[model samples]
Target: EFLENYFLGIFTCEAILKIIALGFLLQPGAYLRNVWNLLDFTVVITGYITVFAQTGTGIDLRTLRAVRVLRPLKLVSGIPSLQVVLKSLIKAMAPLLQIGLLVLFGIVVLAIVGLEFY
Candidate 1:
């Protein structure tokens, strides 16, 4: 628990500094404008919520703990190459989805023909 809180504090400090350096949401390149920063902010906020909920709020926000798992993804923002790869993957999603649909349709048609023959 000590290590969890320690890391949480570090992440919180990082978020605060970034928010101060680059505006929150109104500016052109605000902290929340970047997808990775937005994700970090979410994980930090959820971490706090889970901690506070457990301490005394009794709010039962256990589900929020799952958001912490995304914390490692914040590394993508630190590495330029990784960011490039991730951006390309995201861009490719639409075409991939179309191809997947085409394959599924072909399989379904084959299944129908096989059933009729049987």
Candidate 2:
């Protein structure tokens, strides 16, 4: 718990610093303008929500803690190579989905043929 809170505090500080330096939403290169920063903001906010819920508030927001799993993905923003790879993967998704559907159709057709023969 101590370690979790420690890391949460670090992430929170980073988010605050970025927001201050880049501005929030209006500027051209604002912090929230970048998707990664938006994700970082979400993770930090969810962390606080869970902490407050567990500490003082009567609200049960434990499910929000599951979002903490995305915290590691924050590293992608720090690494340009990872960002490139991720963007490539996102671009490939539509073609990949089509290929996957084609393969599934072939499998289904073969299964139907085998059933008729048997």
Candidate 3:
């Protein structure tokens, strides 16, 4: 509990600083434009809710603790090369899905042929 709260406090402070640096009220602002900041903001809010929900209310927020794993994704967003690769992957999703389905179909056909031979 102590370690969790300690990390939460640090994340909260970091979120506050980011909000300050990005300006809270700007439309389509620097902060909103950057995916990393958005991810950081989301993780920080989730962490806060998990901490407070556990302490202030009777409801268990154990499921929300899993959201902390997303914090590491913020590092990916920070890297320009990784961002480009991620964008490329998203763009290639349709082709990838088609290839995957084709491969699955081939495996099913092979299995059927082997079964018949036996």
Q: Note the Cα lDDT for every prediction shown.
A: 0.90, 0.92, 0.81
Lowest-sum lDDT 10-residue window in model 3 = 24-33
**What are the runs in model 1 whose C-alpha is more than 4 Å off?**
1-3, 26-28
lDDT of 3: 0.81
- Tens digit of per-residue lDDT, candidate 1, span 6-37: 98999999999999999999999999999899
Give the candidate number with the greatest TM-score.
2
For candidate 1, the TM-score is 0.81
Model 2: lowest-lDDT 10 consecutive positions: 57-66
Relative to the true structure, candidate 2 reaches a TM of 0.87
User: For each predicted model, how many residue pairs clash, with residues at least 3 apart or on different chains?
Assistant: 0, 0, 0
Off by over 4 Å in 3: 25-28, 85-95
The candidate, 1 or 2, that scores higher on TM-score is 2
Give the RMSD in angstroms, all C-alphas superposed, for model 2: 1.8
Angstrom error at residue 113, model 2:
1.2
Model 2 Cα shift for residue 52 (angstroms):
1.9
Give one digit per residue, the lDDT tens place, for model 2 in 31-116.
99899999999989998888888999788875797897888788888899999999999999999999999999999999999999
| Candidate 1 root-mean-square deviation in Å | 2.2
